[model samples]
Target: MKTSLKRFFAGVAAAAMAVGGLALGATSAQAAGPVASTQTGSLTVKAANGTTGHTLKAYLVAAYNSDYQAASDGSLNFDTFKYVVTKDNGTKSNDESAVKAALTDAGVKASASGSASSAAEEGLRQLTGQSAGTPFGYTDGTATASAAERKFADALAKKLTATDSTKWTPSNVQDLTPGDGKFTADLNPEGLYLVVDTYAQKDGSKSTQSVPMLVGTKFANAAITTQPAGVGEVDMKNVTVPVHKEVVTDNTGKAANNTPSYNIGDTVYFHLSTTIPDYSGYAADPTLSDPTGKTIRQLNLDDEFEAGKFTGTKVVSVKDATTAIGDQQGVLENGKDYDVTGEDTDTVTVDLKRLVNGADGAKTGWKTGDVIDVIVSGVLSADATTTDKANTDAADKTGADSNGNSNKVTLNYSNNPKDNSQQNKVPGDTVNVYSFNLNVHKVNQDNNPLGGAEFKIVDKADEATPLQFTVSGSTYTHAKKDTDGAIETLKSGADGSIAVKGLKAGTYVVTETKAPAGFFQGALPSYTVTIAEHYTNDKTNTTRTSTKSGDDWLDTLTYSNTPDNYGLVTKDATSPSTWTVKNVKSITQLPKTGAAGIAFFSVIGVAVVALAALFAVRARKASRLA
Candidate 1:
């Protein structure tokens, strides 16, 4: 009975071993099967306005059991899946937004909350195919997923949504959140399309699409505006041309008669006549106005004309037998003589009537038809006689007569045989009578007078001798000297100088009308000075003790001390010991002299010289005595 029981148990044990081997074989086969790949999708986006394009792809895999997780099993159960969206011209935001929108429109239920791997898987599943269980096999599932993904992509491309496109203004699309599966607004549509990539546990996938957005419209019309034309106006008026006139002389001391010429001493008048145009009235009468506008109607020309004068005269005589007159005499032209009795004709009778007619000297003074009368007079050499015998006898009585005849005749005529030509009258040459005009205008305008500002006459010593300047009128002023020996309108202060403020740049004569008490007015130097710009303190103070007429005037004053002690003295050699005139004079005379040790040393040399001289004298006497 025991042996039988052992056989049965052994058989049972062997059967158990066979069953375990079969189970081990089954597990190995499952591990060795084809790996199941988790699918992923990628998104790509493109921008129109200088932006890049993007693309997205979907990767699908067949479902597998969890036992196929090992490599030997050839099954892949993805713990983490990655979906990459690349932007050509667009940013990651744009790619993400485009992908989310694509999935949402395709009826994909994207979870608002999930891990990156779970979200990626969910998004891929939605893009591939609807969650409906379709029984076709692994290939069928892949085809369905691909078709669905393609449809989703096609829908996204049809809208032409791109970054930087005006039409791509999506609502609630500002920032993209990871794993949220929502659209982002950070899109730029400048260039290229969007690219989407997906990574699965066992495989990778991708998709691409082109974005069409209006980029050229942003800068379609750009140009600058045109400007308007311009015109200019100018004035047309008379431009005055200057006329210059000068006097020229001939060899003879007298002015040449060619022109209405006059010697330097001759009374000559200047007459200017403009053709009155019959419209504009003749210029007001000619008058001489001084620089101060003082007019003189009858100014004596003699005062200014002294150089030209006839110093002396000589007489000449002519005598001949043919002419009844025995002798003829007249004033002789300088350096010239005439022979009356020689072959040149001692007597030639001048036809006055013919001379006047041929000479054309009738016209005179402004009127084209007026006639001029000429007069000639001179000392005669002898008395005249009608009979030729008597004329000859008179010519002989006077030595001025030729042929020793006393009958010499002096001739005078109204009409001479000279002086008629256009060249006779020159501009500025005074005729017997004419009309002219004169006009004078002030160039500088008047300025408002400022009071308290002093006017001074400065000399070379820079002495500020106060003078009064009166604002007589707008343009004129009178600077009169006062009884105090100083001028009025000038301010003299304790500083021993005058201060002229607000005075225009010009020349002024500063005079001292009143010297300080006990000071001799005339004894003080007066200066004739000029107040130059930028020279004085701009106030123009003459700083000398004298009047404007003194010689020791200075244009500028160097106080030597500070302005506070300007007129003060530190020492006094003469009376009134406390800072007296002596001290001021000494300081002014020798600027280097002072109470310092250097001044004391200056006298030491004189003392030493005197002592040496005394010793030399003593030595000389001793030598002589010895």
Candidate 2:
């Protein structure tokens, strides 16, 4: 029996060893398989403004371990985890009730289990694959408990060191330092997780995990400035006017001095000084008169020196007489009424009709110290009046001056018949009068009048369109030139044309009366049309030039004349009525020659071809031998 029992025991022992070996092999195989993916779990703790640094560290470690387990398994469920937090200096802390309270306020539930170890164990049991009976023995070896705890501790240390002493404390919980404490844990799971160990001191000092508690994924930062919706409107009243140059002269005699001439619809500005004490009140009045008795139409204060006060400066527009008042008058006397003598003659004339027809007509004749209205306009014409001769003979006749001295015939008039006596006439004042001198003479190269020539003023170049001239109280007319370049009559139309009258042959210039409106008159040309002696009788042959042969006979002559269609000239003397012909030569009768170096180059090219052939033969022989 003893032997049988021994054998039985040995067999049992052998079987047990076999079973243990099988289990060991299976465990080894499981460990060699792919590691399971991990998830992230977060634990956030908040404490009062002033909490002990050691206490904050302890809380962070405990919270990290709890979340890591809860995320690993499903059974363990603990909000807060207890720990014995220690600083690098070995300073240790017990239960951190302030940290626990802060965590509770931050949405963390304190564990009723109470003990740090128990809370940690229970939290671990809350996650999957993590229980007291699990493969990891409820310690969450697969989770990041140890790493997370270390991270949380380091963050807590940084937080406590960076706290500001004043505005923050454990109780008041104000002035919390940003990122003072932080915690982060990397898990081997599909999701992310984080554990934040944060604390505040009673004195506003704070300590948190060094790294921010991260869970799941990260989000992008927010934008700063945004684009505007629409553009702003511009106000013209607030805009400034651009400055421009203007010409201000004494009289219309220098009208050409108006550099920038005014157009019909141009807006012009004027500067005027007033003797009036308070010119500010006149700004609102369109018709403000100056001290010189000149009226300003559309008068306005350019700008105020000291608000609502005028510095005697005014602006006015240039337009027709009725539009701008006081523009036609001269300056007025200080503290006095309008004065006709002091008024601007130009502006007064424009406003004359208005003054004469209105109540002011009785005071038409101006003097000093009278309140008179003046209109300002830029339409002052330099050539306001002009004169023309009624008869050429009368116009050509020389006249004697008042002193009986012989002078050239000229036209003269009293500029202002109303003031014929020239009572207030001044050199600078504008004058209205007829032409002073006929100034009829030939135009020279310098545009000056030439002597000893009577300009044959014609209406048209066609001889049939002869011009009529009044001479010595009689009218003289000329006719057009015939095919022979001679006129038919000197009194009336003949040979289907008009008579050609006699005139002094010389250069003459034709000019128009007044330049069309809106156009400036250009300077006249120097040279004018020449009326030769021949043109008086034969208008068509006016510009003809004759060349005589040995016998003084007109053999072959050439004529160059304007208005070319009037007549023709014969080239032969025997038949002076018709033209002759002549023969010309061909162009190919000229010379030709060969290039010098080109022939030599051609010969060299032939020699180069021969040499190339010899070399090719030698090269072929050498190849065959090789």
- Model 2 weakest lDDT span, ten residues long: 231-240
* Residue lDDT tens for model 1, 73-119: 33211221112223233232244455455556656666634333233
Off by over 4 Å in 1: 1-478, 481-611, 622-626
The digit string of per-residue lDDT tens for model 2 on 1-626 reads 01121111111111111222223333232233222222232222222222333131211222121121221333212222112211222232322432333233333343634434333222222222111221111112111222222222223333443445311121111121223333222222222122223322223222211222222211001120211111010000000111111123322211212122221112222211111111110111123333432222111111111111111222232222122234344432222222222122222111221221122322223311122222222321112111111122322122211111110101111111111111111111111111111122222223232222222334334434433333321123221232223322122111111112222223333222222222222221122234321100111111112411001101111211232111111133432111211111111111112221333345567889999999999999999999
lDDT of 1: 0.22
lDDT of 2 at 179: 31
Which regions of candidate 2 deviate over 4 angstroms?
1-424, 428-458, 461-465, 471-626
Predictions in order: lDDT: 0.22, 0.22
- C-alpha RMSD between model 1 and the true structure: 48.9
RMSD of each: 48.9, 42.7
